[model samples]
Target: MKRFHVHVSVENLDKSVQFYSTLFGQAPSVVKADYAKWMLDDPRINFAISRRGETVGVDHLGLQVDSEEELLDLRSRLEVADIGFRVESQIGCCYARSNKHWTTDPAGVAWETYHTLGSIPTFHAREEKTSTAACCASDSGQAGTFNTRRETTRAKHCC
Candidate 1:
C-alpha cells in the first residue's frame, strides 16, 4: 500500500514533535535531534518534520511507494509526460535512506516521489547534486493552491 506523506519545516523539532504527538495521539516512530516522523497506521500518514528554518508548516508533500519497481514506474511515467525530476540517493534527509524524485506543480510547492531504502541514524539536509529538474520546475507558485481542488475531491471520493 501507498502512504500519505507530508513534510514540514519547523523552528523547534521538540516543540513540533510534542504538538503533533498530542494531536495525533502517539509519539513519533522515528525521532532525531532535527527531525521527527510518525508513521501513523490509523490515519496512514507518513508525517515528518525537518528543522531547517523558522517556518512552522509544510516543506513538501508526497507519496511513498512500497517498492523500487513502483518508483521506477513513476519515473517512467513522468518521463513520458515530459516532466523533469531531481533524483537523490541515500543522503540523510527526512530521517531515512530514500531514493527521491522531486517535482513541482503549477504552484511552487514541491512534490516528492520517494522509496525508502532503509532507516538512517541522523537527520541532515539532503545534498542533491543532480542537474535534472522536475515537472513545472519554473513555476514559483505554492503547491497547495494548485492541488487543493484535486486533493479535496480525492479525500471525498477516494479516501
Candidate 2:
C-alpha cells in the first residue's frame, strides 16, 4: 500500500497546527518543536507541516510506500517516464529514515517517492550547506534545483 504525502512549510507552526487539526478533526500523530505530521487513515495521506525557515507554502508532494518492493516499483515507473530522478538510500529527513527518489515534474514541481524505514530524532541528520543535498520547491513551485549528478538539492530540507 502507499500513502499520499504532502509537506508544507508554514510561518507559524502552532497556528497552522491548530487550523489543520480542526480541519482534519484530529491532532497530529507526531509533534515536535519545529514540525508536525498527520498520518491520516481516512484520506490515507501523510500530511506534514514545518517551520523550517523556507517559503511559506506547499513545499513538495510525494508518495510514501509501505515496502521496499513497492518503492522499487514506483522507481521503475519513474524511470520509464525518463524525466530524470535521483535516489537517496537510507537518508534521514522529516524526523524519519527513508529511501527516496527525488524528481521534478514538467512544470518544475518537486516530487518525491519514498519508503520509510524507521523514525529519527531530528528533522535531518545534519544541516547541509551544499546544493546537492535535497530538493525543495519555492513558492512559485518552479525554483527547485536539480543537480543531475546526484539529482538532489538542499534548497530546503526534504520531506
Candidate 3:
C-alpha cells in the first residue's frame, strides 16, 4: 500500500495544528514542538506540517510506501522515466528514519518516494557540515530543489 504525503511549512504550529485538526476532524497522530503529522486512512494521506522551514507554504510532496519492495518499484519507475533523482538510505528526518528517492518536477516542486523505516528522536537526525544550497544533487551535479537536508540553502525539512 502507498499513502500520499504532503508536507507544509507553517508560520504558527499551534494555530496550524488547530486548523488542520478541525479540518481533518481529528487530532494529529503525532505532534512535536515544531511539527505535527496526521495519518488519515479515510483520505489515505500522510499530511504533515512544520515550522522548520524558511518558506511557509507547501514544502514538498511525496508517496509513502508500506514496504521495501514497493519503494524499489517506485524507484524503478522513476528510473524508467529518465528523471534524475537523489537517494538517501536510512536517513532520519521528520522524526522518522526512512529510505527516500527525491526528484524535482517540471515546475520545480520536490517529489519524494520513500518507505519509513522507524521513528527518530529529532526532526532531522543527520548533522551535515555543508550548507544547504537550494535543492538536491541532480545527475548533472547541479543543485536541484527538494526539501531534504542536502547540501544547499539551509532550509530544514524531512522526507
Candidate 3 colliding pairs, count: 5
Clashing pairs in 2: 134-153
Candidate 2 lDDT for residue 107: 66
Could you give candidate 2's per-residue lDDT for residues 20-85 as a string of tens digits?
Answer: 999999999999988899999999999999887357888788999999999989988876766567
Candidate 2 TM-score, C-alpha based:
0.83
Question: Please, what is the TM-score per model?
Answer: 0.72, 0.83, 0.83
**C-alpha RMSD in Å of predicted model 3 compared with the true structure:** 4.7
Q: Residue-wise lDDT of candidate 3 within 9-36, one digit each (tens)?
A: 8999999999999999999999998789
Q: Which pairs of residues collide in model 3?
A: 132-152, 132-153, 133-151, 133-152, 133-153
- lDDT, ranked from best to worst: 3, 2, 1
Q: Where is model 3 poorest over a 10-residue stretch in terms of lDDT?
A: 133-142
lDDT of every model, 2 decimals: 0.62, 0.76, 0.77
Candidate 2's error at 53, in angstroms? 4.9
